[model samples]
Target: MSIRDGGGTGEVAGRPRLAGPPTRLRAPPAASRPGVGRAAMPNAPPREFCTFYVAPPLLSPYFSVGGRACWEIKMRIARRAQRLAGTLAILVSVASATAAAGDADPDVYLLIGQSNMAGRAPIPDDAQGPLDRCVLLNDRDAWEPAANPLNRYSTIRKDLKMQKLGPGWGFAQALLAAAPKARIGLVVNARGGSRIEEWKKGTRFYNEAVRRAQAAMKAGTLRGVLWHQGESNATDPDYLDKLKQLVLDLRADLGKPDLPFVAGQVAKDSPVNAHLARLPQTVPGTACVSAEGLKTIDGTHFDTAGQLELGRRYAESINKLRRAE
Candidate 1:
């Protein structure tokens, strides 16, 4: 995608760049405040994983033809191989065309959030699955898995290895299932341990994310953003206003004020109370999904299955919004 004249050089706010994890609300002493989400109420343990899978490379075969003939047999075998290769190529091209021509054009969704958006998931040994319309934009603008869950920068405090199981994958799967004609492109830009304020426009991470998403949009690849953040805002009293402004700023910058954006509330009993947590979703043109039954044991994230469910919830939210529009 072509970059605007001063696009990549602008700073977010007056800050030189985003530095460190943004400030979250300070944890209050046990006696003073109510906790976040349901985990705070009773016997709820943090959600845990049942399995995991790492993706593998896709392979294509190469063939050489040999024959027992002095001349004609060898020529025939070579011709046959050439015809077979041509047929295979045509089949592949047809498949790709069919996939693209289904119903609605698939969207490239940007998943930006905190640790929950990045962590791990359990992909099966046979899970090298289809990616006809899914893609992720790295810092370099190359496409990888649009929904990789593991935040390379975030630490999973637990002894168990965290797998890549972010909600974006589920969202993609759900969208495909519901609308086979739609393609889903995902770009992740969430930083673990980072707060909302840290994501302000000028920071490197913020600018980088904006650059990536904007590039995708300019290339006509992105459809919208799937935002699930705000645990960091638990401590910021002015968070609601700031978040509202952030949404306005993003739409203005992206040139899609009516962009189909969908977001989710954090699970109950989080560091921030549930009531206050719902404010950002209230912003115009933004939709929010309830996190009541979701959330992991640590109370800060969603478990593997929870992430899938969250993705489904997000798809439903998006579909409903689209229908409303």
Candidate 2:
């Protein structure tokens, strides 16, 4: 396999450089009402942790107030507190569970981009099998055994076949071989025929990727990301800018400021191959793998052999990055 880096200034056109420390999300205030001190509700739902609090009503009933009125006011406050407490309890439990799971050092990689990343190539009979050590984030938002066609949850295209060999399995296998003692998890979030513009911070596709990555992180450490796109935006001059922002946003969202990002070049005959090759020069903590000699089934999607090779190249790039660190 041949890998080439196009020489260009690190700066991306029409995009400002990210500066300062990464932004952190703050928890919501404990109390929304003034003079109403908040305290944790007692007997929160079983097995569920909660941060909910009961707030004393802003106004207290005077001694002269009617007994019924005072009782009614107290009941209302109690009911509201119960509901809020239940909701917060569930959230706290989930958060705690996620935190606990994320403490493990399982090696996790996120796969994102268009068709190639989603695995459009047909699977050969011999290669049709399961990886015992590989885990995938499946359609139901749960981690299960890694299977062929790594990305099967995408709603972007219904006509596309959901079952076919993809690079994710190969990539996972390569990772397992490199680190036999480490647990491997693959977060597949690619959509077919998606443009870079659709992968902006707030876009559905981008949010989904972030959500899946976050969930996957709960099960392992986010080591790197594998990207295979650009065919859709091959002609857009600002494609590099959009891609840069996407990478920056992903890093920020994943809370891994220096996460390794590996991008794969399109097929040798693709019009966007040149742009794809420039990823290393345009993005930091990133490298590009060449698909120069890969055999494509339809001049676009790689065949099973090509997919396996691509996965190996991605693993190699990631290993190189880890060593450099």
Candidate 3:
């Protein structure tokens, strides 16, 4: 018996005949068919048991000489299959990583300013929820499901109990409604009764805001900034001037000169809203949401309903600004 190579194939003593154990291995049951799923054939061997023959005879043929060439060919095929499986595994891993990143990191928005912007309204027991596709940057600077008392994570906020629903809740809900597929991230760092001067460039409030926003940017992106401070600075005749500078400084500091800034009016009918209304005129990318008809909890802070409504208004304005671009 001798063997020879014909092209990349092998030729043995004669045409190769089926040779293996005499044990019968039946075909997979009809249940193994595409839609049926399971291979219920009791006589079927494990999938790894392959003899390349329907019913190989009980012939323990010599595996040397004539069969050596054939054996070598089978080895080459098995090696190639192993390499291909390795490549496929790598591709699956990469795809899973990409999906994980998208799920965890979404579009980020910076929430800055006074108590109202920080959500000073009372949230009822049956208040909404941790919005879908929306996450919040908590006090530890970690992303988590968005919920009421959104400003509770503010490193520079008032007492935790004082933290309640702010515009962030309604704003996220409204934004998601407009862009259902998008995920949102909010970094809230507002201080209660804080004046605009406190958020100016180089100020403690301003510095903390920029830090939190930058950290959030690592997870997602800075889409816009929401401002809702002014009650504490109601009597300042130069409030608008300070505000314009704040916007300018923020745009520069955040490296988003054209960032959309949506400012909400306070609960009180302070002259601050008047200045806020004129913000867009002096600033390039600025919008003011009116607090008219909006009710407050204590003549100073918006009630839960009012807070949610105000958030919707802010989201509407922000969306319009984004669309304009």
Candidate 4:
């Protein structure tokens, strides 16, 4: 039989012709019914025929026109999923890195000067312990829990066996207490009987202090400098000039020109008390704390109570400076 063209005669030559428009063969609808696609059904019963019917497009090699479209759709979906997963992974990594950086940034304070800054009094029972949020940069260039006798390398002391209490411990404690969430790091480089001349730029003590301060800065931000000296330079005529120069040199070395330098006055009876009291006026970004009422152990270094008070005073001055900034 011959096929008839639309609007053509019913018969072609002597053969009979098929009637009407020819019916086109189409692949069956894709298996979109639940539990009937390529995916397996969950919790199917034993002996159950969970048929995952392949569409007619996949039945023959030469009839794979629809199958190509299906494969391409799947590929697009897979690429989209991979891109989404990669984006999520990158976001998580960035968030983790930011948190780690914040955790490592603490408030760092540099403590330097002479015996008073080194703490020459006996450690009080209440102050003879380590602070949780305070870390001391020791002479060995290591970070350890901050406690009493912070300036361990003071030349006046033979060993830590006879270590005396210094204001550093109390200063850290007070600062931490005032700012509960703050992580405080103390870089103590004070030495007993250290004169202002010894702390001049290019000197061993000044170089060491700068080195330690720079090292401590790696673990946190440099906040301020706590200075309590003048006992040895009391009689020097150029004491104030040398001290002012020291502050400038320190700021230059640390790369923090406006860094706060809080100096504490010597005992009331000390001959250098008058000079120390004028520190704030003589130096920029500097303040002086009073030791007028504080008692001394042997008419020189502060006693336990005095050290604690001095630390609190230093913390107060530091806080004030920070607020002004």
Candidate 5:
């Protein structure tokens, strides 16, 4: 009944025992063990998913495996292996928890601008199914599967039927293509005929966009911004200054100094195109995507094909900006 630990040969404390050897203690069952119990982490794969295996000890020529059979020794070795498997299981569970946390917080993107950004083109028949690892911040400030008419959730948006495919759709797809495992969140808040002046900080248009962005940030981090306005301000020479201020203000308000801001040109001929072209030159973390060959449905808004292409371009630009910083 009394016990003291020593070399397997402890009569009392440190010496060899009068008996052949001290009895070995067996481990508890896997179900009762601490870490190897089960897939305890939320959203974690089952225990069977990350199991560790040990080769049978009866297969080796130089080791006990395939050598002589000893029940007590074999049981002790089996218990040690069980503990090892339990530790590995625990490590895998912790890793799963970290991945789930990341899934919970998505990569939020803010899309804002005028009608063009709101997408005036008609939805194509081949529009794909729900994007993998992507979600849209709905008008009610809730997250749902990202789909066509990404601007539908715009708090200051127009009629539903008018909502069509925009760069957000393609942008998300292209972004996912680059990093397949990443989760994307879109927070679009654009109006039909708004100009740069309307989107100025403190205005209702600007306030609503910021509000939605902040709300979405609760479940995700603001990763990038996509802008496609300037059709209304094409002739205004002061558009560049306002855009710079807008970008700066947004970065300040959103608390991401180096936040990537990408502005898409409305049309190749628009005067604002020149200003948009020069954005990246003036701003620190900004880039401009061209709509040069992109055909527009109404000589203003990008058509379905053009919108999708521009979305891919936006993804490429954002990736480069992140790398440059």
Candidate 6:
């Protein structure tokens, strides 16, 4: 008789259906039998050895022995999991401590002024000078290394023929060289060919600088404001008085009655006669630079060499003022 005559089988309609391959219901391998520990589990199925998944529930008392064995296996797995978690926590803590130690010191600086103080030099080749603590405020207003050796304000020359090298970058390098321990920051807001009229009491440029100065003062520190502009309003005879009023407004607005100001006299041989136009800002501070032989052949802007020297002169003036204070 067929095995199905005595044993019930799953049936579809009146025909009996096989319970699947007999091999599927065969007992586990001898190596996976009870009393075999983890030390002898090399030949066991992965599911029986690994604790990553839940085991099938044991419903019969015959399986009570299996249930007790499962409990012991689970305990060993839990202990190993706890040990791994603790190791991970310790590794994370150590990594954080190392990062914090490396960031113990930081540098900061502020750069503010007119077009000259905004930078107009060409990008220097091999400008890979070491900057231990210097940074530039990029065109996007993000802080980056001052390694470009050229400033964004210089891009104006493509449109405006009158643009030339200003003293901003030279000044920055000088400060970095003079105080390598300090961090540099630039807060530039200069308009090309802007006159005292445009920068006067009710105007935006002047007012904005004032507001920035106030904010800087609240922080109790401001490097200084470098002034390299004056040709635009030098033609006015009353430029001195207007400049004095401007100084008053700037100081009052910045909340510093005697804030340090750095000024540079124009180089004289300008083909455009821009040098002949001189305003009182030329003599505002005690450290005005003499631009006698430094004018470019064009009689307007400083050439590469002239601009570098101009920067040096400006830095010297600033150093003098700083030393006095």
Using lDDT as the yardstick, the better of models 4 and 5 is: 5
Candidate 2, residues 205-268, lDDT tens digits: the string is 8888888778766546789989889888777777667777888999998899889998888875
The TM-score measured for candidate 3 stands at 0.69
Task: Identify the runs in model 5 with alpha carbons over 4 angstroms from their true place.
Answer: 1-102
Q: List, residue by residue over 122-214, the lDDT tens digit for candidate 4.
A: 887876667776767665454556677777743333456646788887787788888887878788777778788888999888888888888
How many Å off is the CA of 304 in candidate 2? 0.9
Model 3 superposed RMSD (Cα): 19.2
Q: For residues 185-290, write the lDDT of model 3, one tens digit per residue.
A: 8899989988887787898889999988987776677989999988998878898899899888888888999999988888777988889999999897899999
The true-versus-predicted C-alpha distance at residue 219 of model 4, in Å, is 1.2
TM-score winner between candidates 4 and 6: 4
Mind giving the per-residue lDDT tens digits that candidate 1 earns over 233-287?
7666676676666667777777777666776777656554453346435675677
Tens-place lDDT digits, model 5, residues 110-159 = 99998878888777776655566777877657666677788887878989
User: Candidates' TM-scores?
Assistant: 0.61, 0.65, 0.69, 0.67, 0.68, 0.56
Candidate 1 ranges with C-alpha deviation above 4 Å: 1-106, 121-132, 144-163, 271-282, 295-297
Residue 39 deviation, candidate 2, in Å?
50
Which ranking of candidates, highest lDDT first?
5, 3, 4, 2, 1, 6
Number of the top TM-score candidate: 3
* lDDT computed for candidate 3: 0.70
Query: TM-score of predicted model 2?
Result: 0.65
State each candidate's clash count: 35, 1, 1, 1, 2, 7
RMSD of each: 21.7, 19.3, 19.2, 26.3, 17.7, 23.3
Model 5, residue 248: what's the lDDT?
98
Best candidate according to lDDT: 5
User: What do the candidate models score in CA lDDT, each in turn?
Assistant: 0.53, 0.65, 0.70, 0.66, 0.71, 0.45
Local error of candidate 2 at residue 282 (angstroms):
2.4
Off by over 4 Å in 6: 1-115, 119-121, 128-132, 138-142, 147-165, 212-220, 269-286
